[model samples]
Target: MKVAALDIDGTLYPGALGLQLLQALTANGISDKSKSEDVFKVVEKYHFNEIDFQTMATSAYTLFAEAIAGISQAVMQCIARQVWQQERTKLFPFVPKLIDILNSQGYSLVLISGSPDEIVCCLAEEFGISKYQGSIFATHQGKYTGKVNLLSGSLGKKYSIFLQMIKDWRVNLEESLAIGDSITDTALLQ
Candidate 1:
């Protein structure tokens, strides 16, 4: 049950593309531009208060989820993939070395992200991470299907999938480590 979880946005990468995207949306004069700023404001408010990582992460997730709700899955995937490829320039310097070390030590590595699966998968591969885990809320066939599948977020991220991984691999949590840079990951770390 040696598990290690890594957060994608600020934890893995240096800059916040999510916030940048929000700014872009506002600059472009997209409808309801203020909503984007409001989300960032919420995030900033939490950060200013020195909120715990889990709470901050949850708030960030909520912001993203709300903003992405009405968008089509295809568009969401495109946006996520594009942002990851174009906007992100640097990752934590220790990420690659740490993953290798953890793998050698027989610790299972899990990349849990609130970002879309398409984006997270790309990052995992780029970082040479062998396995991937995370959630993307999306629809199919260019329709806004109300139901969203959990690619790897919230409870599914912290417990369900992690537990299943342990059960399938016959490992124990005592030997596991979860690493993340957000408040949302507090649950997984605990």
Candidate 2:
């Protein structure tokens, strides 16, 4: 199948959705005040050009990993759904039209995101994308182990994950397309 890798945060939505996920996690109590402070500081540094985007991403992901450790996937999924429902109105109007056109053309849509798997999967299902991949929080039995198995933002990680999916699904990259924004998406876009 020809693949279309779509980034969720900015491409699918009119603006960035990263903070919405963070807010959901915080509201659900997966993240504490210290973690919030740390992530905010990273954002501040990135905004001030004191640190590169990679550093900001790594720091934010680290804080997220620490905050979400040991939480059940079910709980996270619930929070993800709630967040989506609340923010659904903010989604860009053209995204669905684009998805329809892509679908009609037989492109296999995959939502590849640095966001949590819960949010990515929920959004994928809502948008009728059958496949997706996102940062995986380690799970043991039914509960989170609080460890990140693969981070989408880590250097080369997004490309590796997409490459594996391409191989496993027998996707044709020569006929595929990737849509994304931000330097974090450079690997996937390439």
Best by TM-score: 2
Best by lDDT: 2
Number of clashes found in candidate 1 = 16
In angstroms, the error of model 1 at 69 is 4.0
Over 44-145, each residue of candidate 2 has an lDDT whose tens digit, in order, gives: 898999998888888887777776667777887888888888887887888878999999999988887887787787788888877788787788888877
Summarize candidate 1's per-residue lDDT along 42-102 as a digit string, tens digits.
Answer: 6777669866545665666555555555555555555556666766566778877887888
Kindly report which residue stretches of model 1 are placed more than 4 angstroms away from their true locations once superposed.
15-32, 50-63, 128-131, 138-140, 143-157
Per-residue lDDT value at 183 in model 1: 52
- Each model's TM-score? 0.69, 0.89
Residue-level error in angstroms, candidate 1, position 166? 3.6
Off by over 4 Å in 2: 15-18, 28-30
RMSD of each: 4.0, 1.9
lDDT of 2 at 173: 79
The local distance difference test score of each candidate is: 0.62, 0.78
